[model samples]
Target: MSAALDQTGSAGHWSPVESWSRDELESYQLERLREQLGRLARSPGHYGDLFGRMGFEPEEIRELSDITALPFTHKADYVASVAAAPPHGRFVSVPMSEVRRIHFSSGTTAKPTPQFWTQRDLDRWADLYARTAHAQGVEPGDVFQCLFTYTWFVGGLGATLGYQRAGATCIPAGSQDTARQISTIFEYGTTVLCGTPSFIVHLGEEIEKRGLSPATSKVRAIMVGGEPGASVPATRKRIQDLWDARCYDFYGCLEFQPIAGECEAQSGPHIAEDFVCAEIVDPDTKAPVPDGTPGVLVVTHLDKQAGPLVRWWTGDIVVRDRSRCGCGRTHARLVGGVHGRADDMLIVRGVNVFPSAVEDVVRAIPGLGDEYQIVVDRSVRDDATGFLKGIRLRVEGSDPALPARLAEAIKQRLSIRAEIELLPPGSLERTTHKAKRLVRADD
Candidate 1:
């Protein structure tokens, strides 16, 4: 057994594994990785076929770096597998009788990907979330209001169970009804608010609009994820200023439950090294990159069952740091959280642009509102071949000089020229869940 798992830790930590040395963490990870891969080899599923095709054996994995040799499981692969076998695909390791719950991806691309979780899988997810919440300072007295979607999306129920495990009074006030949510916060004395960065900012705006101050509220910690805003410096500052709370960024997807989170240091979110082996790789090349280099994040579940995934490509851009955090945790940190998805990155005039980058620039401007959208329209040519003409940033602001100021800022920061459209405040749609930052004009 791992020493961290065997021994308990201080009140500030949920587990002793958080402070394990690099070698100790990797040793534990290797043992778990080999066990999971061995199960994959013995099982009759997509992984077996993938291993056979690659002529790779689980026993050949002698060190952690050997994980790079394993095949990456992409979203397209999962979709195709599901098409071949409906409902839970061949990727599900256990039988249907064992599956206790089924969650799904947000399905922003095509159809929703089903995630199979047995009771053990579910318990592990909740425990991982509990560890993250504990790191964010959730105690028995804290009342947590989860604002992430509660349906097929895994964010809500997983977080709700986790905070409850951490001894907090949890309210499953999922994403809806901004006014009622604010009232619930005051009535319940909710000390912890969990939602995407966009909704929290929206809630803060609504509070101020009602001739109230969100700073005076009892909320001390705001845990935000399911989007990129919480890691953006300007957006983080905006949220902290509005709520007078310590804003923490969590990085996880439906496929992988709550896997990483920020501690009290607030520098970056520490990856749960014992639960998952996180790799930063070049998006196109799929080769491991050095620490501090921006790359697509690939994760492998170390202690998952029912549907264990190997080298699941997340596509979210991020930088990793291996240095021990000031909070005294030895787990590697995702330095700026998720920096948009590789698929969502837009290339304009020989420059790559991400919506979060635009947001970072926009939010830093003095008079801009919290809501903004990046509109993509085409330029029709004589031959009927449509090309990406340009990007138009639609922002809500009443300041007459805002357009020129924002355009200049974008040019300076992103090295690309984009048309700026300033609308009156409240013109853009407010979201209670993940904010839609990019949209095609034709759509």
Candidate 2:
């Protein structure tokens, strides 16, 4: 009944999918792609209509490269399809009666979008979650504390199933209630902590407020996702110091909950190449870029039942390294761990800036707290031209010199000057779930 045995199944232990040669892996991918295609064609969904409109026949895909023939599935396309078809949309691959769960995106930019999952889809999601946990060194005896939101978000489901797959006990510590979170760690001897990087940092601050250090907790490792912080050296070290635990980074999207994860080496997160195919391409030209080149992240789901995504363009900017990692997983790793987003780009005084870039600077400063917001102020606007007033940073802290120091650091790193305003230590609101990084302030 050990985790290793559980993963091995009765046949053997551990799946060697990552260890397969390039050709072998591609062959498997092609098989999965074909199976998904046939299912899509048979189902009454938008994908089948899309494939037909493009004159693409599933039989025509003789090789993996032939996937390029299919048209890309854009999120806007899904939004439109939902408006036209209603509810789950025609893109759903299963019968409407089979869907057991429905999750909504936070959708800061627009209204929340609906995603449906059948029992089969949930099962696959659990398997992927578990695979990541085991790959990241989650052991049989470890106790995992799940602190993500389970109300409408998909993250909690991923952590719960992953712990179950790894044969570890999971404490369902839902988001909110910081005091309860701190008590559970010591009371239950939680060995694994999983949540957003900001929340983890806030948890550390709360623990310290009670005259306790991170070292006093039994938790040994922290898995961070839903935001970019663990990849940044300063933030990673801060959280590690908070609880004296190892930090691991995970990358996933609302479209696909589990994409890649960092192994013990902590170099970068390895892509789930088996289930998903990732490509870095120019955000504007949509052309494939070199492995290490920074570009927009484009994902294609090779396996999925409820929502079959084909060449879905994710708006995030990133870099990938396919070189073999020291951890021995042959899957590609994400470099810089989601540097920024194409949509979140800010034009501040003729300089292009990202919220994450500002974050890198803020989290590195000593006196700053977790709750912070960036504002791109616009003095005047017209149809022809606009004036760049400046970018203002409102951080949670009361230190007298912290604002000047933070502004100087940002100017040095981004080559763009920023105005910092320090608020009371607990003046700004803290997020129990996702951290909001930017707010527009125009005057």
Candidate 3:
């Protein structure tokens, strides 16, 4: 067993309850809430506007639970606010000169959303990430190969800084040139490999194509993010089987950095209550959902000084389990990490199919990576009136023959025939940031 697995086995039995009592955790969250609100009140423009709109003084929010009374901030509001004010947007707390770095959202739906970070904000972000890495068994002297993109997106830089803070030597190999990444993994004796679930599978395939067995590779732990592959049983199993490494899942967003993360036990992602306040609510009524019930995830950043967000509505869906996790952390746990985005759900012929569901089925097929895309287009021929035409899926595959086989399997599983297209191996561009898997041609 690898060092990470050994640590996981040893620490797996410890529950989050052992780390802190419920009262103690609540106290800590309340303290952080005061500090964050004070910082927001002192800032100029946007925060003041929000506070005025809420018709309450920042001081009125004494306890952490009082945060629920505040109105939720949606992505559309932030985008509009930013458009009205260029560059940093009204959310920026510090002056432009004080800002050290800028990170933008992957913007899978529309234009990318930009987030500014001061040196202090960066330090806090890194510290939280380091805590997560250490809890997951990444140790000092361990070499980490960061496979996420290092462009405007925050995943690459945030992870690299966090790993470095944890005393790991990170190989800044952003997602590109799989051959070179595999070569570096061997050369540097990297112990931890970090990337999206799909990219990791692609790297594994490249390693096999180059006559490399990932089981014999120096990598010991694989950390995945940017998607829900870690929570999916078949997809997670495939990645672990391919890399011969302990796979840990982390769930976060551009609006709120590092909301919840996995430890060695891999039971679920533990929410970082010290830094974030999470609310699982029914997407339709905006009412709190019972524990274990899947709902829309809303977040509030507690320690962010540069661009502190309050009750930010993240379009992701997840189930929150307040019961203690297997890991020794008092924070709430996301039972299966992020299930899927609210917008990604498709109702096909009285059956609901999420892109993630399709992805799970596709990834389960042997010899296929997570590089496929679902193309939905309107049927060119007019159908009979009163019956709406359903969605079509054009799955991208590396091998020319795999699409037909995959279509057959999907038909058997989903009980619907989906048009599958087999493009060239590199036909679909590999992205280092968020993988754009679902494309609506009719839109």
Q: Which regions in candidate 3 have their CA more than 4 angstroms from the true location?
A: 1-18, 62-65, 106-112, 367-370, 379-391, 395-429
Candidate 2 residue spans exceeding 4 A from truth: 1-14, 107-111, 348-351, 379-390
Task: Record all residue pairs in model 1 with backbone atoms less than 3 Å apart, i.e. clashing.
Answer: none
**Among all windows of ten consecutive residues in candidate 3, which has the lowest summed lDDT?**
9-18
**lDDT, candidate 2, 7-66, per-residue tens:** 442222235665566677778888888887877876667878777787777888888767
Model 3 TM-score is 0.86
Global local distance difference test of model 1: 0.87
Those runs of model 1 whose alpha carbons end farther than 4 Å from true positions after fitting are: 1-11, 379-390
TM for candidate 2 is 0.92
Report the number of backbone clashes for model 1.
0
Q: Pick the candidate with the highest lDDT.
A: 1
The root-mean-square deviation over C-alpha atoms between each candidate and the true structure, in angstroms, is 2.7, 2.9, 4.5
lDDT of each: 0.87, 0.80, 0.77
Cα error, residue 346 of model 1, in Å, equals 2.9
C-alpha root-mean-square deviation, candidate 1: 2.7
